[model samples]
Target: MNDAVHSIAAKSAAPLPKSAGVTGRTNDPARTMAEILKVATHEFADKGLAGARIDEIAAATRTSKRMIYYYFGSKEGLYIAVLEESYRRVRSIESELNLENLPPEEALRTLVGFTFDHHNGNQDYVRLVMSENMLRGQYIAQSKSIQALNVPAIRSIRDLYDRGVVEGVFRPGVDPIDIHANISALTFFNVSNQYTFSQIFKHQMQDPQVLAQRRANVIDVLVRYLRA
Candidate 1:
């Protein structure tokens, strides 16, 4: 080719500035992903998988659809990612509670209370869980690492229960998984059923006094059940 043609082609073919690219590259990819996940969490929780829109999430995060897809591959991929992050966040906080340092009964109570507070305060997490259940957990089942995130929770309970058994405070033969399940059920109900239960029963579940009483009642119920 002639010099003029070669020069023109080179100019035309040269890479665009990173700023000019469609990828929407960020200096802080981790922060960008976190932001996207944060917005997507609400989107999925509020709309579920079938109803959530990537464009809306991107708009909310000041990101592009391409960037979200670049990071998470697809809408379902992002949903799965949000689920992982939700579970990871809860499990991360649960791990940091340091329940092992407390006595078994106290540990159980603390764990239950924390779960209650977490579910109550972070209703989005509960909503995401409920949304997933509505799909029979098909998306959560796609997550390879989510189950791993929850293992430490059960292990923590197991350690505390073993200590309680040794100290003769908690009865023996109870499965740690069952204890975890019971605690989860008791705490989960407070958030999951609050609106419906409150409406049906004609009571204010969000009342501070009522909440305090319910929290104490749940803790008492579990503690009494495990006492030797």
Candidate 2:
């Protein structure tokens, strides 16, 4: 009986009904699960764990909470599932970039570009993750599998730093962990507090051209700071 478990159990008990006028029989449990997850992800992102309603999720997916529980076990479980899948998709995309093959400078540029694009394009994902972190990652750290997904991104960045140091392209003393934190902080800040940032700066950061220019500026700043 912790608050998290209690929340999950409450959601599990009250399931919603399916939508009307949608009569289709399909043996695509996988597709159904994916659809549910896609809707759930947005709900969780918009509301955070505490505020997200299972009924809302059900309505969005046109399914019942029982079905969600049947597939994912509980709301906590569903939240973790959404996060793991999201991380997997992002990691898969990062893996394909193959920064290891590029020269140090080019690899850094590509990596930064990808990070910028990811945060900008997937603002919901960014908000979801920031909310999780703000909660001290209590839910996310519970899953070992989810934690393991970060390894590839970490290793790739480390490799880039190593190569850069060897080639005299970057300052020799930068720690990979520190570098990663800086990059995340820079990219996440603009999106995470877009409203506040807009209020303070008196402009919309959501504009596509503005975001694109910011992305390039971030890459330039990082490159200049790291380069020897």
Candidate 3:
């Protein structure tokens, strides 16, 4: 995404051979990649794609730069990989929610609460999302699997809403995508605008009490809107 890192891909001479070094290189390649991603995620989220350095990530991961490239293909490739992993992680956890077993209203509330907790606890996800938007979503656009990764989120809403309507618990004719947009908007704003909003409004949005109230409000707002 950054012009400076654009050519880093072409500079990759070749794959790196495994070596015994603290470069985070080890006999286990998967573990090495995971270590790299863990460090790189913070680096990229903190500094963004343009400012993030492979050398810094390499140092942090104790893995060679060549090793990083060998796994991801390029800096951009690694960045995309990071984005994909972030989305995949949240979605993967969401799928295990097993909302189908709960009543529609409780399921919706649980989902909203979980979404809020996730956005609050995983500020990295929100920051990465904010960083991506600042780039006008160009890097994320390069990612082919991102869209597919998010499909289940909307599908989950659709399934719940359909069941609710059939049971006469939720109102009919609500678009699942619209419901999803509302849910995300409500939860996402808490983390994305925390600092600026706090400074501007003198409200400590991150305070546990405040967050608890906001969390309740988010769940109530959606439940009220969806219920028959």
Candidate 4:
């Protein structure tokens, strides 16, 4: 991985306390918002939209359902907030790669490696995202913030594709959006469905060595396909 990607992975993997006050007071609005989001993420991941409960989130966060409503407006609003926040965090990490500065192949490798590491490390986030998509993204699209966060990343990938074509590293016919979807599907599907994947494959999918090999294979395939 490149230095930027490595830096982000390191920061994400670093251990964090269960609760940290963003505003230096447990009940401060910012701190409370953070706590509520953390709890909501876990709740949504463990239980799909149909299964998640605001009351459980309130109790887990040591806050009230009224406070959650006051802060996020509604259950759908809270779900959107969690989705937006999750996307923001992932996008922030992705932005650090600066693929514009690297050669085409190296840039592709960096992106694939970063994506694989991210999903592998944050399985719960992956589950929550997949669960949302399973519901056809009705909730996510309602969040203007989530919609807005996607433009920069999409533009960045297009810029990279342009660069690769100019350098004769990738075929001129490739669509940037297609490339993005391919990468996302490859990295996300297996991890998001690890339990079923393991059952089908008849092995423990959580083995560290197996995951490392999977990441390597994903990068190799993506790089070869782009270079071809």
* Candidate 2 C-alpha lDDT tens digits along 1-228: 224433543444443335322235353456667888899889889999889888888877776776777667788888887787788888889899989899999999999889888988888889889878879988787765666788888899899989999989998988888888888888887788889989999888989888888888999989998999
Tens-digit lDDT track of model 3 for 187-228: 999999899999999999999999999999999999999989
The whole-model lDDT of each prediction reads 0.84, 0.80, 0.86, 0.78
The list of candidate 3 runs beyond 4 A from truth reads 1-25
Question: TM-score of the candidate numbered 3?
Answer: 0.90
- Residue 5 in model 2: lDDT: 33
Sorted by lDDT (best first), the order is: 3, 1, 2, 4
- Kindly give the stretch of ten consecutive residues in candidate 1 with the minimal lDDT sum: 1-10
Candidate 2 Cα misplacement greater than 4 A, ranges: 1-23
Deviation (Å) of 60 in candidate 2:
2.2
TM-score of each predicted structure versus truth: 0.89, 0.87, 0.90, 0.85
Model 4 lDDT-worst window of ten: 1-10
- lDDT of model 3, residue 228: 97
> In model 4, where do residues sit more than 4 Å from their true spots?
1-27
lDDT by residue (113-213, candidate 4, tens digit) is 89888888888789888898799988776666677787887888888878888888877788888888889988997687788989988877679888888
For model 3, give the 10-residue run with minimal summed lDDT: 3-12
